[model samples]
Target: MSGIMKISDKEFYSLRSLILEHFGINIQEQKRTLLVVRLQKLLQAQGFKTFREYYNYLIRDSSPDRLHELIDSISTNFSFFFREHKHFDYLSKTVLPLLVERQKKRNSKNIRIWSAGCSTGEEPYTIVMLMLEFFGIEYAMWNAGVLATDISTRALKKAMKGIYSQDKIRHVPAGLNKKFFNKADEGKLVINETIRNNVTFRRLNLMKPTFPFKKKFHIIFCRNVMIYFNQQTRNDLIRKFHNVSKPGSFLFIGHSETLDTSRNLYKYVMPATYMRI
Candidate 1:
């Protein structure tokens, strides 16, 4: 294994540019150390003596698996069940009710929601549970389900397994937690099959020029995902999202992230929430 490898300026720029191009993550000059810290172990384990070598190999490799591994190391997947409770509250009180009313008038029972950048399945599962709670017996009648996607295959694998330690779900309301998760040995909880089946997990890179979704979504939860992107990337990505959503659909972003409302594509509905115009 290589010991104490340092990234030269050229190497940093090369790798940083690749990451930006592929993942829309802008690694600033200040984050040079951060990039190294995140990838040092992978570099050593893979027997690369320097960042340049790793970058070269990445460019030479035709398959996407290596790039996926690189992203798994670089991307931060910090999420917990009910991480932002207010979104669920809004869904239950405002969004779902409104959607139900609209669907009722159209006589269409389809309800589409997308959890873009869903990490470790918490956000999507929470949405499923909320839908279950909201519709109760009628849930089966509506064609409602969550499309959960992330760039990290590692995270998606964990999401598909639907297992979480007790601490990860501590914030989940006791009632919902009890209803949605089954107790596993060693204090881990497995998300129930019903809730698990309601969410479809997929590995997707948000930087793709076009999303392959054939149907427009009614609600999109892209919280905390765009924080890694720069202004231009965010704009393009949000425009793509707008294009793939139904008119008057809802978009939920992270509390720390803000959108330029002046674009007129989306109107501000609430804190970190917007409506497609």
Candidate 2:
């Protein structure tokens, strides 16, 4: 009772500004109670009697680790293997063949894919599995690894482990499960080394003005992440994504999310799917 404190409007706006400015997550009025609920335990644990105290600590901490922890507390990492089945189907049936031919014409075997905001390793590992399925024996000849990144260190740590609860993987197809995952203790599934190695997990704050990649990605999967951002933030982030992807690369968003096709950065191929123009 002594430690728990209600967030005042002033404190809420101050903290919200910090989060929005640094992380690009727009904490709308509707989400204030949600944010309070999420951060209450963290504030109590840190011995902060008020949200203002917590905000002060966050601001005074110069190291990125504190910000990382804040984002970890606030960010949602709700995802499962093959969560959006159509994306995988399209990748395997349509996109991969075209990508293969394009690579061949360039005389390059490099296949770069980025699973932006890949939570808990499911999406990226699934991508690797599909690529393996698509290429089969020829997979060995192609440098077809995926760059999987997220802002939360906690999520990134779990992703790097490549282990998931069996229930979490229930959506994965039977063939892929048998091939890429091995049973773990207490009904968990650990991704096989091959599939695990095919993904490189990194901690990335998407709000950063410039991503650290030297080379542009061939396909970028940034689904469901932009829903937290406002329109301006999403537009700016999309532009940055456009700059960092190769021409004719594919962009996948959440089924419920839509890009502004008027910007001409991408052409709408289907619902939540866009191709770089």
Candidate 3:
């Protein structure tokens, strides 16, 4: 505790306001100490002596890189392959099958899925694997892939590497693991090119006023990403998602999250699952 730097209340509020305005993350008052602790090393590395100085530097920096770094420091990036199993079951049992049938009727082979806030690539990769398994030999006939976006460039870099420790992939279903991953040195599993190539990872901030996607998505997985936001931010983001989703498209959120269906953009399908109406 002797070497620890404390953030003044005013400094904490200033930093909190900036983060809320730019990233839509509402840091609670209780997290003031946590914020100081998390940012202490960053400040030392940047040679800043006080939180006020760091705040000034953050505002003066023109490039988004600093902001990104701040986000990387503050945001939690906890994820693994198939962290929640029920959603995957729903995806396999209901969503993909319906989409496939709909597309077939239209004589179209294109399938679009968006994995919003896909940290370190687990969720999106799992989706691609499921699609491949669902279509089997016919997968090659369809223009199907997943667009995985997250705010952390660091996470995206790790996702692009396509390597995971055995522990990280421990919950991956059997047989599929053998088919999609190869054993590397030091007990690591490297994702095969087939699954890795089908999932594209990009850095995107969900707080942005506009999403720059040209095509509407049939399925959007934004699980566990909105827990950091306030209710207003979450509602605004859900509206944006509804606008960009095809009618009747599936939206999968974390099991702990609930939507205010009164907005009428989406109708409840099940816990944490909604269909764009």
Candidate 3 has an lDDT of: 0.91
lDDT of 2: 0.90
Q: How good is model 3 by TM-score?
A: 0.97
What is the lDDT for 235 in model 3?
97
lDDT (tens digit, per residue) of candidate 3 on 8-46: 889999999999998888999998878888888889989
lDDT (tens digit, per residue) of candidate 2 on 135-176: 999999999999999998899999998889987899988787
Models 1 onward score TM values of 0.97, 0.97, 0.97
The models' CA-based lDDT, in order, is: 0.93, 0.90, 0.91
| lDDT-superior candidate, 1 or 2 | 1
lDDT by residue (tens digit), candidate 1, 1-277: 4445689999999999999999999999999998998999998889988898899999997579999889999998999998878988999999999999999999999999999999899999999999999999999999999999999999999999999998789889878888999988888999999999999998888999899999999999999999999999999989999999999899999999999889899999889999999
| Predicted structure 2, TM vs. truth | 0.97
lDDT at position 171, candidate 3: 88
